[model samples]
Target: MKFNWEGVMPAVTTKFTKDDKLDLKMFQTNIKAQVDAGVHGIVLGGTLGEASTLLESEKRQLTKSTLEVVEGKIPVLMNIAEQSTKGAIYAAQQAQQDGASGLMILPPMRYKSGDRETVTYFKEVAKNTDLPIMIYNNPVDYKIEVTLDMFDEMLECKNIQAVKESTRDTTNITRIINKFGTRLKIMTGVDTIALESLLMGADGWVAGLVCAFPAETVAIYELQKAGRIKEAIEIYRWFLPLLELDINPKLVQNIKLAEVYTNIGTENVRAPRLPLFGDERKNVIQIIESSLKTRPTLPAYKNL
Candidate 1:
């Protein structure tokens, strides 16, 4: 299948075994489920996938494995979030070499660069690659906003194909559209406001909680796109609680917790990250349980 920077694409979580190794089988299973559920694409090794802790070899393995299972049924987008421009270029080259469909590239990780530095870093990587790129801009957490002016400068780099708008501000969606029109394909990166962003004319979604509720995610996107706003909101209202998990700091744990119910992925994570326990665990599960009890059937859109 051909991939545009549009529709419902998931930033899937990286799965780990109880022994703390990459659970490639489970990872592929999760990606397969995403495609099977009609997601427009799959984004691997992103923040949800814990890119910082993954070994270079492991990341490549993920890219290779993801492409195989997806089998070109949908675009398999690999995330490159390295801290150095040189490092990012190398990762992009590796993905291109392995036949990845595209990449979701973050600004230089760790050390927050100012606007000039950020634009330069993105351009440097884009100059060296033929693969399409999605600029991952989450100013709220990354502390380095990829401002519209910086994007104006970034226009010189031809491979900068899309924007993952996760500033946690809905107005930015309209602002981008007003500024550039279709110059940049905009993907809603925040889960909580995904419906609003889609309604505001974002071209796609790079969602985290979709790992658990892939069908619902795709349904909401399709329903909204088809102009069945009322039906889409009906599902969105039921999904909002679980969707809220994606915006929090414990997102990895929270999402995996929801995944456990789906039984496609596990809750295990690397050190500095652990399973949710105590009140936190109970609180998230309670929300998931409450929602499950009243889970809505998909809106039955034939286009799906």
Candidate 2:
């Protein structure tokens, strides 16, 4: 299957039981919601999915459940953010065996390795797995950026075919196109600047807020591709406030709250993370409720 790294692929959050066990049933329920909403694909075990806090078994269960729910209707890409190169390779191979269509891999987390180490790490993992890979380059959040020079070293690994461009600087989207062209699929990883990235010719969006506002996200992308900027901006302006929730260290909690408000998923994130309370909770809830009160109607896509 040729995976077109276009449209919205929500890095779905991991719903947990109160005891912090992987709530596979609720997880499946959330995944089905994304598919039914017409998202191009759904990503599991992502940064928003709280991958850093999940155990190995929980991660596998999440991916397996995602594959079962999606049933090949769309690509089920899993996030692989292991701290070691060998660990990343092993996880990548295991995910392919588990039926994931692709992977969104980050640089060796917590290491802050130099360019040579980062390049070698990604190349090794890409070579070991047959599934397509999207290199996650979010220096703002993860503190590691997959620079274009590093990408030049990656041309040897053809499977490393996509980049989640979260540099937070919009021009990097253009920079990637100027240098690599179609060799890499550029997905706007940061939510707030997603519309801008799409206008700059981003191939797709590995979105966070889309988990809550899927229809709006897809509509903005469709309208933009159809050359309807004024229309897209109208929605983008409305969505910007909610989209701002996709950034920062507490994004998992913030996005999970969005899911709760939309009733697509629960906000039961695991430990080391807790539900928002008091002013923080009220502030986010206020924003989401206000947006819901005036949500935009989605126009039909060309094909549909």
Candidate 3:
């Protein structure tokens, strides 16, 4: 089915066993929880899912698990992002076969040089798959940015249908909306800037923080769409600090910790991506505790 690339798309975490293996049951449970919380979509195998640490077979398992739970209630956007275009294409093909609704493609991370290489990388991947793709422009993690000029060039590819703008620059978002708004759907990936992006004409939000707090995130988007900017901002302020935590390199650890705190998912993550410890671990726990204390209660998961 063709899916609308709008509203809250959670960059979901891949839950793991204490032994660090993929825990399919936990993963599916999390997906169902998000759907129950009313998220518009689910992004499997994204940065937040620690895709780098997962094996090819594990990725397939995750795709299958997510599809089983989602069951077409909402769109399922698979993150087919890897260090090589070949791997990305392979993953995209696998996701499509497994019933993914669309693809969220990131630039090749290994080669971090010229714009020419980046442009070529996207072109090759787009050629390999028929799925509508959302360009994942996150410079901080990938060490490369899809500049405005490169964005324009990639738009020529028919399947390059959308962009998840994580640059945190309102001007860039504004520029893209002003220029290519007709050609592409621009969704803000950064949770903190989601309100600003929507106000400035972004189509939706693909957020990492939404995994831990789906109801709150959905509420924020619904409020904005209802023309309730003041109400949205109030909710945005309550979520800003927790959203900031999602951008940190230690996001996987922090998010899992929050999940544990909320009793939503396991805190286990695969290595060499270790869980936060010592003072850092303590601080994250405190943050989740504090946020829960002040966060507004959702009727569906009131105990959380």
Candidate 4:
């Protein structure tokens, strides 16, 4: 279960029952779909996974349960979005103990640290855990940019291996590669621009919409890796509208609704986040349904 930090790794949604309990059965079902579709890895408790709402025990349960379903077929990486350095370090240690293959960690949540502080927070967490880490450099949403200079400092930590590049600027992929070379791997965290990122030499995609469209998502990555550019674009163009859902504010709810239509998951979310409603719900459904009407038949490609 060594994490290569490459390929389509879903920022999978957390399934919930009617009473807002962990619906592990449904969670496993989605995991199986991802595995069967030939994904390279699985990322748990991410933004799309509703990481903010999950309890510590629930996160541990998710890691264990995802490992059970993947059965070591692919690496399962738990996300760490804690508000404190100590909390982040403890979460990282807990994930390793829970048998997670790796971790996708963010800079300190709820507090925007400077470049030096951000690097320190990540380095501290990296030192405390043996697990390989994919640093989530999502300044667009989180407001703390992990600049290339910060990364230069963080390279001291061997475990700080990969980056979940969500800056929305595709050129940053090339910038990271230029600055760090192979020392740090880059995975596209934004769904809409994933193919562009890959074409620019990103190692993998930490996807969100893949939770509902596993096969299509995997197809895009595999096709790209195989140098089937035309084929990959055909699928990506069809997938663009659906993939845009991941960038919205209610991404969790947006993706969950897509899951409901796709029959892979339910629309149940925790309190403070409800299912999509009114015109918003109608518009999203229109997009999902429209895409489903003409979903493309994927061309055969080797599962890399």
Per lDDT, the best of the predicted structures is 4
Which pairs clash inside model 3?
none
Q: Write the per-residue lDDT of candidate 2 for residues 170-286, one digit (tens) a residue.
A: 999989999988988899988899999999999989998988878888888888988988888999999998999887677888888988888888889888789998999899999
- Residue 30 lDDT (model 3): 84
TM-scores for all candidates: the values are 0.97, 0.96, 0.94, 0.98
Give one digit per residue, the lDDT tens place, for model 3 in 177-296.
Answer: 778866878889887788899888888999877888888888888888878777778888988889888878898888888887767788898888888989998888878888889997
Q: How much is the lDDT of residue 209 in candidate 4?
A: 94
Please write out the lDDT profile of model 1 over residues 1-304, one tens digit for every residue: 2249998888889989999999989988888888888888989889889988999888888888888888878888889899899999999999889888888999888998988899999999999988888999988888999999999999877778799999989999999999998988899998889999999989999988899999999999999999899999999999999998987889999999899998889999999899999999999999999999999888566464
Residue-pair clashes per prediction, in order, are 0, 0, 0, 0
By summed lDDT, the worst window of 10 consecutive residues in model 3 runs over 295-304
Of the candidates shown, which would achieve the greatest TM-score relative to the real structure?
4
Candidate order by decreasing TM-score = 4, 1, 2, 3
Badly placed stretches (over 4 Å) of model 4 are: none
lDDT of each: 0.89, 0.87, 0.83, 0.92
Worst ten-residue run, lDDT, model 2? Answer: 295-304
